[model samples]
Target: MAEQGPHFLMVGGVPRDWRDKRTVAEAVFNDPLPFLDVESAHTHEVLSSAMAAELVDLGEGIIDVASVRGRNRLLTRAIAGAHYSGVIEI
Candidate 1:
């Protein structure tokens, strides 16, 4: 499916001005974050797959945007980018 509605990028848990999804995806793809163990790989696989498919779920309560930190924030942004691209539904 293709994106719907006006384009906007999710910033700080809120939608902002439109930016190409590809650009956002690239930034997220190369983002560096400290990992301790399995968590890092798991996170990479999940977010990478989402980026590849441009499909993700921004389910309620999954992220506390105001307090999210580290890799969590990057993951959130990835999903948000998908949403903005209309590749993923909210």
Candidate 2:
């Protein structure tokens, strides 16, 4: 199968930005409270990698964004870093 969207990865214990689907799927998943913007997906929501990293750092052991081994490193790291667990769509 071919991955077809912007993928994310966990770097430096945080989720960084990348368009690689394979890399985004190999990891867990995370959902930040302040980062939720489901209104628009076509227009790029401006957010820096540093900010994202900071979010992950703040949410350490409190979230999971992983979907595969290395595909979604950030997701996986977030999952490992989560403090609370539940369902959230953002």
Please list the C-alpha lDDT of all candidates, in the order they appear. Answer: 0.44, 0.37
Clashing pairs in 1: none
Clashes of 1: 0
13, model 1: CA deviation in Å? Answer: 31
Cα TM-score per model? 0.24, 0.18
lDDT of 1 at 29: 45
Error of 1 at 11 (Å): 34
> lDDT tens digits, residues 27-48, model 1?
3547553332323445444445
Among all candidates shown, the one with the greatest TM-score: 1
Indicate the residue-level lDDT of 23 in model 2. Answer: 73
